[model samples]
Target: MAAVIDLNEDVHTLLPLTEHRPIGTLPFAGRYRLIDFPLSAITAADIHSVGLFMPESERSVQDHIRSGAAWNLDLIQGGVFLFPYVATRDYQNDDLRARYYENYTQFLRGSGSKYTVVMGAKNVANVNLNAILNYHKAGDNRITTVYKKLPLDRIRPTDWTLALSEQGTASAIVQAKERHDDQGKNEIPSFMDIYLLATTDLIDLLDDAAQSHVFRRLPELLRDYVLANNANAFEYTGYLARIDSIQRYYDSNLQMLDDASFQSLLLSSVPILTKSKNEVPSFFAKDATVVNSLLGTGTYIEGTVQDSVVFRNVVIHHDALVDHAVVMQGSKISTGSTVKYAILDKGVVIGPNLTIVGKPDKPIVLRKNQTVFRESEVEGSAHA
Candidate 1:
């Protein structure tokens, strides 16, 4: 079994949502969180031991991944370990690098595994690390990176790039600049932020990084190491949806409506594991109209829902309409209100006769536990 290192990127893009929890604990797909896929992938690889190094508040993450039983990480021998931020230093400083070095070395030294798989968990993809490990074991490279070749137009500016050599070795790591001014023929290979390496070798790299004062994240540091030394690249051809912004998250959820996309992810050989919830069946009223939407259990739907994802224990009152939106758990859509092209966080309440609307491109997000009041009619003479 390989020792796994799940590191936080210190990415602050997913604001309001991530205000209270780490990126891994952010909710997704109505029933699962962002961390579920990565944990599932880790378990699928049969790697029982993992060290999740969090860079921010980890209470929510801990709560979600409690005992790690769902992913078979509750073994007595080697199980999930939480390594929260312990060093007082800037994320991009030498102290931070040394901090990672300390934790990583400590973890790997006692893991009883020879190989390590390091990755970021925020991205959405059904990665088969078993294949990646096979690729690594078959090659003589010190590090093997997993990357996906996406079209330039489909690629986002924030995505990282990996330029591979003719021998499939990584030659360069490129950070995507601003969007292309011309739509000319320029395709880029986006790095999947996943790597497989020998644990001892990873320790050696950490020591080297500490000595050299390498402050960048592991991916950037690994890029430099790969350039100087021989490292392989594992090309991944699969569905990849990275949820960074609200728009992307909303879009990704909506994209699940497609059979191919939905089937490719959730229907993988290794099922996505999430914390179990004890909830009863959803109740839909006779007048409730739902189309092309996902409804979680214990929900009472008395309104019209279309192209949306509704979570557990939610109440959609009569005469309410939800369209092109995402509603979280314990939220209530009061009667005679319309929520369109918006996202309501957990425990949000839409008051009666309110119409909350947002543009298709920029969806309005109501914070958790918020209550939108009904719009009042202005008493005035008409056509004065």
Candidate 2:
């Protein structure tokens, strides 16, 4: 089977962090990118042929997945193919639909595989695609979609929830907004935007979409197909974080600090892979104190860090304090500065003697390449 990774996610809520990079390339867990989860799942299933559909500006995605060597998708036959949309001011829903249909149809037709697995990059989960594939093969259904039971708050307004029949197949696809009466339910089956279907069936669905002039995203179209055909629903009881907003993103990263969550997601039998980086070991001063934090290589720490994830090459000065924060690569906390409940993007420098703090629910965000010298300057920072 071949695979398709869609990178066109709604990233407006993750601005500044996603302003320059696609959602797929966003740094996660102090090391892996969001795309690594799906790509690693595909690789673990021994699927070498893959296609990535990206938006107009995809330099970050290209830079990270260059030659697809890390995922073993650089083979001469049935290797990785990137289909990026050309930047245009006149782009509309119809144009996007036509473009997707054309590229998706061509990719599936050329993959030379009977089955195709399509997934998006926003939902963070370490799925065992091989097991799902085996289950799909054993069943007689033409389509299978994955879902996880989640709380009401975790379900986004745009997300699709399933109404399963007695046979465990999806009888209807319900939008989160339309389920206001079901708020009392403890948990709802939320779709993961992952689908597996025969190549010919997928092609037929795309052709029907083109003929019907339906302008919808690929995931939405797949949802409609599932409901119409009574697709089989596979329950995924793993740790899932649907990152459609800034609060979810922040919470998801910090959730990794928990031993159980980290072990279940990262230390599982199936490894999550990414582009390798070689750096020197991180240094810590004699008086430095770090507790319950994950630090990347090439870091120099001299301050008190608690409950945080610090990326590579970050520097925390002698008297600074980082509490419950996510510090990206190349960020520096000056000697007298204190950052608490915040996210510092790459190359951010907090000037001396400044204290920037935010509430636990709403973390302050410093965009990429920002240098803040005073408290007033931080007031202008983005707050999730």
Candidate 3:
């Protein structure tokens, strides 16, 4: 099976601290990037011929994914191909689904591959395509989409929702403008973003959609094409989070710091991939007190830190107090400064005797490269 990794859309919403950098390149857990998840998934599945679907991100994306060798995607037989958007001669309007179908069709036509599996970089899941491929081969279905169940409250801010049928079959479950009203019942649908399609079937559908100028999403187009046709659903019962916003991103990182059980789920079978940083070990000075925090490599702490994540190269000065916060790379907390429930971006500096605090509902965000004066109220600086 051929795996296609989609890196077209910007995933900056997830990494709010580093808005300048793309989500795929954002520093995750001390060393890895967000794109490492999908790359690791495909590598674990042994899918060598992975086609990266990137349309607009030409400059920065190329530098990051130069050859895909970091994730073992640089293969001899079926390596990775960076596909650019191929616009048709006659264009109607700006249509997202139309662009998706056309771009994928062009990729398939250029490269002669049989089976195709589409994946995105947002979700963090170690999925082995062996089971899904076996299911596809056993049945006569033309398409298969990956889905996982999510809580009702957690389902509000996401794009994909599962709308299951009585027969337990999955129908159209994609990006909805608003939650679809199904009478008085409040049944949510499974979000199906990752799609799998046969080479021939995908070509046919793309051609049809292109000719009709109907730029419907993959789920909607496929649903309409196959009125009574079989579209299988492969349930993924693992740890998965479609990191969408800043809060979710921070929360997901903190979740990885969970004790044995939760951490075991990811490192158990297929390990997640990321760029390796060979840095020195972390050091703690005298009188340093750290509690419930994730301290990365090359960090020096001499103060009290509680319930926080301190990334690489962070420094906590003497007499400083930090709680329930996220400190990015190269951040410094000076002496006598107190920080609570705030997100300090990379290279940020908090001066001595300053008090910066934020609540759980609304986290105080200090912009990148910003500095706070000593003995100043952070609330006033936030407004300024």
Top-scoring candidate (TM-score): 2
Candidates 1 and 3: which is better by lDDT? 1
Q: Can you write out model 3's per-residue Cα lDDT over 271-353, one digit (the tens) per residue?
A: 87665678889889889998888888989999998888789999999999988888888999999988887788889999887
TM for every model, in the order presented, reads 0.91, 0.94, 0.83
Please identify model 1 stretches exceeding 4 Å from their true place: 3-7, 87-97, 178-187, 374-384
Ten-residue region with minimum lDDT total, candidate 1: 375-384
User: Model 3 TM-score?
Assistant: 0.83
Clashing residue pairs, backbone N/CA/C < 3 A, model 3: 161-189, 161-190, 162-189, 162-190, 163-189, 163-190
Q: Summarize candidate 2's per-residue lDDT along 151-198 as a digit string, tens digits.
A: 876777767788777788876678887765574688889988889999
Ranking by lDDT: 2, 1, 3
Q: Give the lDDT of residue 141 in candidate 1.
A: 78
